[model samples]
Target chain A: MAVVSGSAEQTVAHTPSTPATPGAPGQTIAIEVVNLVKRYPKATTNAVDGVSFSVPQGEIFGLLGPNGAGKTTTIGILTTFVRQTSGEARIMGIDVAADPMSAKQRIAVVPQQSNLDRSLKVREVLTFHAAYHGIPRAERNARADALLDELGLGDRKRDRINRYSGGMAQRLMIARALMHSPDVLFLDEPTNNLDPQSRLFLWERIQGLNARGLTILLTTHDMIEADQLCQRIAIMDHGKILALDTPAGLKTLIPGGVSLELRVRHAREQPADGASPLLAALRALHGVSKVDETGSDEQDTSGEVTFYRLFAPDAGALIGPATQAVLAQGAELRDLHLARPSLEDVFIYLTGRNLR
Target chain B: MATTTSPTASNLADVAQSTPPTLSLIGGAPRPKHSRLGLILIAFLAIFRRDLAVTAREFIAFLIQVLVQPLFLLFIFGKVLPEIGAAQAGFGAILLPGVVALTVVLTAMQGVTLPLVLDLGFGREIDDRLLAPLPVALVAVEKVLFAAIRGLVAGAVIFPLAWWILGSDYTVRTDRIGMLIGIMVLTALAGAALGLTIGVLIKPEQIGLMFSLIMTPLLFTGCTYYPWASLGSIKWFQILTLFNPLTYGSEGLRYAMTPPQHATVYGHTVTFAISTLATQWIYLGLGGTVVAFFILGVWLFSRRVVS
Candidate 1:
């Protein structure tokens, strides 16, 4: 285990349901951020507000958020790419704000965009990056060559990167980031627009890196990818984390860990707020957490086909009683479904304003 | 062409004094703390190497842009006019020094500014360099220093070309070669400082307008084709030219290279030594300008990198 630094992370508002390693004694934090706030000049609101999290060594952490969430801004601050308006960030316990130069030495970021130098050949690109890290000549050469081979870029070493495909460019960016052998790696949307082959290869590479003791923090909109790759994931919305948990743990966050959907005939004209005995009975059942009648726009005038989404555990066991309750209220059941919620469902449950 | 091994121009930059590394680390592999300065030096050299690789790839295009205009200016007014019996031969003597000054300044300024603008603009390539372990301010410093070195090289290479073009008309004294070299160094740094300022501040879309609005005005008023004293007919313009750093560069080169003697054209003697700005004033003008613009460029650069 790497030597954990001195600063204790602040208490999180939404702690991961499956607690993080909290880094055992003497185990290090690869990345730490606390109460970070940033407002771009002339902007009305903060881009990142009171964001805090820490990843222990050798763990893969995911920050899952929609487009405008503060994932990128938080990563940017920790990587020394953006200056924050307030609060603290430490990379490997080295204060990023106080001495970004030292912090940069231990961290690497593969940015969302392709920022490759178009003018240089592939081999020179990595070597140049290594040189900037103060790696001596012979070692830089060996590392560049070895990284190129491992990333499948050896064949393209002599060619300029202007002609590279999106996948090749992304692979090159990853290779370049690894040239310095940083203790922590941050990948922002690492597989956003990639083909299946490229995505799979990158996933293996990411797992491979973590297996070798490189702590990684990545941001991605792909719920499945985040679910599969990260040991712990944080769901964020509007610059604040709403929930953080393991994939299964996050799945457990939605009211009773499952959803029950039913389409029923209201038998009379019904408005959104107007409810019946069926809803009351369903809510009163054991293990049922919520009964919502969030139907579609096609609700009829005289008689409506209303949709009820019931939150409960072991929804499969609730079918007979739920249906009997519906019929007793003079409503006819049209369609029914019992589901085990995935991370996507949990995400929609926690973050989505319409659902929340 | 393999800049990976070729120290080339960047080695020249290492000759300049560098600041101490501001990094202090803990719980990592034991760094050679005493040699943090060496690490900073290596990073500076890496930037220089990258610049060399990029510049070398388009070196021919760069040389053409730096040389053609000034050469044409010298050829038409200095050589063709004299050969065709249209103007005085002494005009070539007056123009040769200014042309060298123009080449050094143009080469250095464009060398720094164009790459910088492209990187900071749509390229976003500056991100890689900003990620380098050296202090962010030193990245800006290394670029300015490297550009100055390129300017000095361009100035040196231009003399041989100018000598070949003007032939017998290329009359210069070696006695003040030391002062001439000093002026070239200062001119290159001053021009590079200006380049750094423009590169960081200007948008890529505004680059064309930059040449027109800022560069064109600077070129015309910099006294590259005529002596500073000759602007006496336009006293307002003369004082205005004083504000342009290029004016000092051109005037200093003319003073160092052109003899104190006179040349006759239609029985009128054109005296150059008395018709130029003094070495003290030229040195002061360029030295102060370099320092001022360098500070401004670094501040602007640090802000741009941080945010």
Candidate 2:
């Protein structure tokens, strides 16, 4: 998890500070959720419990989480696809429960699964969607053309949807969602099944859309993708947000620790009866936080190897003394490495488990 | 990297900042007209167009089964087998209308059942429409409309084949053109209404069971193969036939096309009259409309699951 800094807004029922108003021309909040709670009947756990979040206008917001984390459920409630068991969800200051049409008018949702008609050509898909929204015929033509050109799908406009490649299909899905020129676009796992290259391409396009003043709400299971694209992220699991902040703020929760790994030969043999001078001296170091032995069961031609995993506030402060202690004990250090607390490490710290 | 802030304060700040916006767009502004009927119409047209496109793609199957199924049945039931037994006695006169009515009913049922079940169960395409900013009633209406179109096509597709198979010896009632059209429309609507009801009641996986349990029995018992009066010898069977809507639809079509029908009603012998045809049409039209509403009612019950 990349650390994130969230820009907070004090919102009343419908008052979001927007640059669209006087004094501030570009500062506007797009989405807000307050004390959201949704439960499915017969299910033992709540899909979302007391969840809350907000998005600023014209920025890309990411909902990052592992599977079964209620990311999709949150989006569904916001989009009015499912009713919230109890909560307040609003889009662009519109209460979704009170007046869904107004909320829908300002937002478009792209579902995780592909639902395009296989028999219709790509162009027909846009035309049909536009019609469904009650867009006038003449305006639909112009909007469809502009969107197709902008998405670089103009040439393949008339090809049947079944014939489009995965990338093309994904692009068309985005284009279809954009047909209404919505202010906020909700994407549910937009790049779930795409190749790495295709995912990157779509990411660039998403960023471009955000830059052009379209607020985006996206959910993803890919940590690197979130780290690279989202300025803020919410780590969710089991229907609740475990942590929400800037990626850096999240990493800071790891407690100023540097992970140092040292590989040694004859690892199974505890250094001199499990209290070799090397181990005793390293334990006496001032800057080191904690240390543990870690390794897989498999061993190479060399009998058994072991790795010393250390967590320290300052690697530089402890490395010299620790290395000297190991050499004095007549231990052979095969390799040594130092790494800062990464997003994955933060996830592990927050959830007590690794992110897949 | 260290802010040195307490966890409680940080959480409070995060919660305050990330709250969602309110659910209403404007205060006292007029709302958009998101009519349930209008949304249903759009969904209906989309399904109809998609089905037509798919049907177009399988032109060979359509030609063989749709265009030829009734024609082949006409030959075997009206001409070939009739020559060997009592099947030929007024069979052409009766069977043509019977097969056409059957074709209309089958097409209508298929129009409603196959797609509705597939979208609701197998394909899950209904999710796309259900997510629209509209009520579930609109979705149900669309399914009925698509079925109506299919029924119309099925009724019309048989005319040319009937012209060729039965030839000029047919009564060829051009004068009853208006009545024929009326009967055709009613039959289609009744079939579609019943089909929609079944579509909503059963899951896609139970389609085969539905065919075997409901449709097959309905067809066999209804007065499709014989006139109601002809089944007088089987007195109880005649009384049971009235319960099947298809019997009324089929009888109405036969009265409109055939010169006359040797039939009975309410355990009494009667003659086929202009009023008899008109009454049957009226009955079917009313029954179909009621049934359509009933289907909509059933659909309202299961809307959440299908959606």
Candidate 3:
């Protein structure tokens, strides 16, 4: 077998390789958790309750949730930063509680905040991290230089860490984590407050690293990031995994996969509250899973206009009949829209709360 | 890291051609994880080395930090006072050890505590050290050891400076070299341990309170300005001094480096002599303080880092 390498080809995004999909079945598991529970000291409730999931080798998995939803707590247990009240977490098959040293040897974490030591020069950060992993001196120097170059931190090698901007420090932190070439990388809120340009670069870097077959598990409160980068996502809330699936798969969990929005005005110019007749007519259409009078807005009209979203198996099947329903009620179809149910909608549907 | 068009990018082609292993940037390295003990040693030393590098880079600032106060204290007390007839003869002999002890103790304590508080309180910069592959406790131990080294080095610098400044007027005893070494090392370690304990126990904002309430009293009551036994008349005051670790530090060094005879007025003899605490009591005090502080430091460090 050809050993996966962080070669030049991986650095240049290859259209041929799809963003990492869930690994094939029977693939070796890189990280595994079975009914993990963590109750912090003096806490009345468990921080992580019966959480269970596994990431296959080389797959990028995400734990997506709002703050205080136990994402960090679960990661703490997996990374051996905190002990679980009960249950098991294993990295590369080594039970973290039983063998954290071996587990830590195989993994690196790029935390949400930059924890780079401000005392040392930029290059020293990577070299010291590599040294901590027991890379031989000569090997560490080589690896540090290469990482600095790869992460585009070579020119800042001699500058003190405090001089670096937020994004630069973050990138340096990533380089430091990758210095030892760890088998598994954990990214906590990887792009939480990053500028758009820096966020895109980080995305590219994450993809490039994954392209080299590095297994990654990241926790993010960002729904878009979770959708774009993770092969699989676990939506968490109140210390539990409320839902877990591929982004597309989770959207299907909502009864209707598509959302159809319509702006309606009655021919008589009456305030366009949901006219009972129009609601009844649309509810009768095939593929119409659900309907609700969402809101009303006064825009360039003396009377209010009704905004209704109809959920259906397919927007194409419902739009024709839905428009007909508005016309049948002698209402004008002022505007129409179609959108796929997003992960955010899936989260709101499952938890009855918005992430932010 | 956000330097998209950094100068290195232009030379990437040339450097890649010159460096063979540049292509193996992320993965190709043969990671030779050491045995358990070996792993801990390597990680511990890497942390120590990083501190060393930073210390080296800030050599001037560190020198000022460790030297200025001690230099002034030694000069005024050992040379100026005696030469101007403001202090008695054997006063230099009595004062040199106390000054040296104070310098070493303060240096070690400041060395670890200041940075530790900053890193743990707000910066979280210590995370890299905490997450090193070795057991997290070793990393804290490594910090204590490095601080102890700084204390020892500060003591070393003071001795030479003392000689140059005071000339023959201040001759610190070198006869009991082994006892002196033991006292200095133990005192240094104790200072470092106490520093680490304070670092974890206090918050960033409370650092001012710590210096004013904790450090200031620690300095004066340490017996650096006067012999512990001299406070015999103020019995309650003498008893209170025992609570400060620096009290043990100064008295222990005085016991090691100063002579036993009474200090005569207006005599600047090279032979070290002073009336101070019992030799056995000093050793026991220094040793006990080290043990207590180390245990507290280790416990608090483990608690902070692991959480």
Measured as a fraction from 0 to 1, the native contacts recovered by model 1 come to 0.40
lDDT per residue, candidate 3, A22-97, as tens digits? 4443455668888899998899999999998877666678899989999999999888888888999987777889
Chain A vs. true chain A, TM-score per candidate? 0.75, 0.74, 0.81
Worst 10 residues of 1 chain B by lDDT: B18-27
lDDT of 2 by residue, A131-172 (tens): 665655676677678777767799989887778887888788
Docking class of 2: incorrect
User: Interface-residue RMSD per candidate?
Assistant: 15.9, 11.3, 8.3
lDDT of 1 by residue, B181-223 (tens): 9999999999999999999999899999999998898888889
Off by over 4 Å in 2: A1-27, A257-338, A354-356, B1-65, B126-128, B131-134, B172-179, B261-294, B297-302, B305-307
Ranking by TM-score: 3, 1, 2
The top-ranked prediction according to DockQ is 3
Residue-level lDDT tens digits of model 3 in B1-307: 2212111232334334543343444443566746888888888888888888888988889988889998898789888888889987657777878788888888898888988898888788988877788887777788888999899989878888887888876666678888888888988998898888998898899989999998889878889988998898999999999888778878878877875554345786343346677878787888887888888888998888766
Instruction: Give each prediction's root-mean-square deviation over alpha carbons.
Output: 10.0, 8.5, 7.0
- Give the alpha-carbon lDDT of every model: 0.80, 0.67, 0.79
Considering only chain B, report the TM-score of model 1. Answer: 0.84
As for candidate 1, its clashing pairs are: A16-A244
Per-residue error (Å), model 3, residue B283? 1.6
For model 2 chain B, give the 10-residue run with minimal summed lDDT: B20-29
